[model samples]
Target: MRLHAASLYYFDAVRRAGSIRAAARRLNVASSAVNRQILKLEDEIGAVLFERVPGGVRLTAAGEALARHVVVVLQDFERARGEIEGLKGARIGHVDIVTIEGLTRTFLPEALGQLHDRAPRITVSATTQGSDRIAAMVTGGQADMGIGFDIQRQPDLRQAAVARFRLGLVAAPGHPLAGRPWVTLNDCIGHRLILPDASLSIHRILRPLLADLPPGEGAFVTSSSVQLMYRMTLAGLGISFQTRLGLEPELARGELVHVPLMRQGEPMWSELGIYVRAGRSLAPSVDLTLRLMADHLVAVAREG
Candidate 1:
């Protein structure tokens, strides 16, 4: 069962726990033992792995490279275990996932619940990032899977599932635009806009629309924080521009409303993608969880 070296485990533990002492505590071993293992690991590799820091340790460039390899090696071993145990109806493994921020609010919770219910021992770590970083994490083998928007097609990434939604305006019910069936940029003029910042891909679509607005009507709150944009709009400060993906509960409660934003008389559309590294054979547990999450998002996206 001991396929990888013991030092790799200690290194991975320290990397995750951020310090030798914390890693030792987690592993129920002595801090000196953990430190000795890490020292030997670095000596073997002929490179410094962790930079001693005030609160915790940080990875050096070489550590980052080795950490990625260690994670892949450990995870593949877990996959092999899961694949064998799956025949006995005892699936267990860990899956690391990265996704775009939008789906975390709505789709992730329900999807994760389904995954847990079906594969009770399968542990998952899900983190949110913008589209580009999500793709990079999956492609680099830092994550087992990724869900993102408009990810660039690359030979190393395999598209697993897809969902397309219309980008629209989100508003408090009392706002002027909330009563509209649909809106155009000209129609949205004079209304203060709470917009996603350039870090998010949606901003690219919004930038050109904002440009067509009258010069003096440019008073808008632009932020990298999605929560800030949502809260600002919910407080009736201004309308936010985004997909209806995460606003279902607010809209259902009558606290907010969404109207399709039109461009050249057509609805502005956004696409969400589910991806995994190409040529990687996922464990039954990881594959099942990915499919569960993808199916949930795809079904939600298809809803009118």
Candidate 2:
């Protein structure tokens, strides 16, 4: 038995989907029924939750306030229901996770493979997002966990595990720097550079090292897309600097090589951490997966 009002679910669905019709489609219900419930909820609460906008609805201030509480309550309710089912020996649960694209190529797949063997009955929904969005999803109670490099710090999120990776100069096998053991900032000067822009955390890490290169010394193309950077590097448009996370497949195939970045003879690395919403108790299935991830990531981090 759910303790919260059913209208709250409708409100949340509409809020997330951005329209009554869309939310209805997702819920497999009629739009009028959904709209009716939201109206009833608005009456009961004596506040407007959403305002009509072109092609959709936007949450009002009251709706935003309610959303915060409603999401937490809904998550808590699901957790409680899952725990209660576990107490009855039922081996079923669902988990939602958000993470950066970087992990999708390496850590995520490996961890999920292990999770599949151990918790076959548990269902998982995973989404690819940047570190900032990943942290938001975890802290907003929309996702059970987040794994990313340089997740935006928030009061409602807590780190569960961590990993570190040195930034590497990714070069096509035909590139001049392809076979180097490592390259210092000085060595990369005057070469064409495919750089991730300020939107990505790598921009910040690269800023200090890249400062040594005088402006206009090297040809530079900047983008916010990691995939584009990888593609450009593969096409030999120029070399790009990145961590080894998403470069595993190509690097292993000898299509590309990862030349570690060093400064003053020391490697420069960035951090990746797993996060969860603070002050929430996880269901057994989620807890089990989390422990597995922590073990797996910590071991990987240790190797670097």
Per-residue lDDT over 1-304 for candidate 2, one digit per residue giving the tens place of the 0 to 100 score = 7688889899989987899999999999999999999999999999999999999999999999999998888888878888888898875688899877667777788998998898788889899876657777887777899887876677888998888888889999988888889998788887899987776777788887677778685547898777888888899989898888877778889999899988778988888888899888887878888999899988787765
In candidate 2, residue 276 scores what lDDT? 90
Tens digit of per-residue lDDT, candidate 1, span 17-104? 8899999999999999999999999999999999999988999999999987887787788788887898787878888898877777
- By summed lDDT, which 10 consecutive residues of candidate 2 come out lowest? 210-219
Best by TM-score: 2
Residue pairs of candidate 1 with colliding backbone atoms: none
Model 1, runs deviating above 4 Å: 14-31, 51-61, 212-216
lDDT value, candidate 1, whole model: 0.85
TM-score of 2: 0.92
